[model samples]
Target: MVQSNHETIRMNPNIQEKPETLTKLFIRKFKKNKLAVLGAVVLLIIILSALLAPWIAPCNPGQTNLANKLAPPGADHWLGTDRFGRDVFSRLLYGGRISLLVGFGSVAGALVIGTTIGAVAGYCGGIIDAILMRFVDIVISIPSIFLLITIVAIFQPGVEKLIFILAITSWTTTARIVRGEFLSLRTREFVLASKTIGTRPSKIIFSHILPNAMGPIIVTATLLIGTVILTEAALSYLGLGVQPPTPSWGNMLEDAQNFTVLLKAPWYPAFPGLMILITVLCFNFVGDGLRDALDPKGNL
Candidate 1:
């Protein structure tokens, strides 16, 4: 027995036998996708610009300069002045802060609520699962955009309100995804072993099962951020979101609705629209990359 153990240790070098951590493995796999890497870079730049808006923005995003109203891109006013003569570039930077904040906040709220409900329903099974899934079905039946519009119209439109509405509406999908994951994971050997060893149900569900299920949850959350941003933009475009002087990309696009501005000053709307497109695309790319990286069958 001692010789067998010695032989095994000798055959498997200590350095080579060390297990790779999930984070490191994930990073390695993620780096193999070029588009995802590019997306990550662009996302980092956008986030940094939004976070540093106060210092980086040339002029006050809210301040108006009648003299410079409708000015095209120039040395003094990069990306030009808006109809109100506010710096387009400054507003763009400041606008990013609000857009990103709403997206992140809404998705985070949804993830928490969805994960908890999904875990309970899936782990408990039977009547609980049926009720929870039925509720999910009802919510899914409603047209989310219509619900959002009605809710926003009934209540005041503000950042906090928008985030709350989005969270309430968006969690259904996440719940479904997490429930499916839990249904499968609960039957796995590790989970069964934990239960057999007298681990508390709560501990087993959260500590063991949730971590294993996070691969899909994380990917879904990343994609959901893009979706929330688009929804916020749509609401703002309809004059029901973020309100003027707050300067989200959506409200900023409202200026383009004017035929005169659209004809004469194309740059006024172009920058914000481009930013929104790029932001959404980057998120999607990152999510796709994450899906591939996290999939067991994907190329390592």
Candidate 2:
């Protein structure tokens, strides 16, 4: 019955399994964290609502009803009306689009700036590395809030401008993180091998090195979105954020500036504050999950 083990092997090619890939392993590990998955789901729902605001919102966020000012949450105006009698629900939905956009835009811009500087500093070494890292330190020393206010004052308050402002002010952290990652990776065997083969410098940096450093870059970017949102909210407090008539979570809280509004119409501020909390917490959960999942030492 057990003729020859060799014969069984020859007849059972299908018995073998393919090696698991890094991406599959990462996904599998990420799925094990239940809270991260739940956070991702809630975040997706919020993002979808924001994207579908035009179709799902009961009224235009800017449309006001003087008679309905400060109306409580009800069927007529869900989540209630603000001081301007604008539909809070609609504003929240539309404002989500702005807030999410700012987060995404700011992070993306920062990544580009930071990654480039880091990659150059890491791969070049010597004078270039020292100069670039010192430049990053200089930027870090500058007061970010003041920088944001100055930029906003010059460019005017708007989503695009705020995105750029946050990107400029917040990129120092990313630059430092990326530079560290690059420095560690730049001396690796694979990088040396690529260089020895006479591969182009750009190719070595981007193709050989960048991919290796992407794990940290991605985690940082995820965490950066929450930071960017909080930054914009802080800017709103200083009146250096997206102006009224445009719905954004920051300016929505800006609506709660008056202490009286918090007391008289608690829902107005509560909803925005709740949204900010949820958004930040969800992102943090996802970032933590990704960091763990991407670790090479993690169980496969």
On lDDT, the leading prediction is 1
What range of 10 consecutive residues in model 1 has the weakest lDDT sum?
1-10
Give per-residue CA lDDT, model 1, range 35-114, as digits (tens): 99999999999999999999999899999988878899999998998888899999999999999999999999999999
Backbone clash pairs for candidate 1 read none
Using Cα atoms with residue i matched to residue i, what is each candidate's TM-score against the true structure? 0.93, 0.92
* Model 1 misplaced stretches (Cα beyond 4 Å): 1-19
Tens-place lDDT digits, model 2, residues 113-169: 999999999889899999999999898888877777888998898888788888877
Off by over 4 Å in 2: 1-17
How big is the RMSD of model 2?
4.1
TM for candidate 1 is: 0.93
TM-score of 2: 0.92
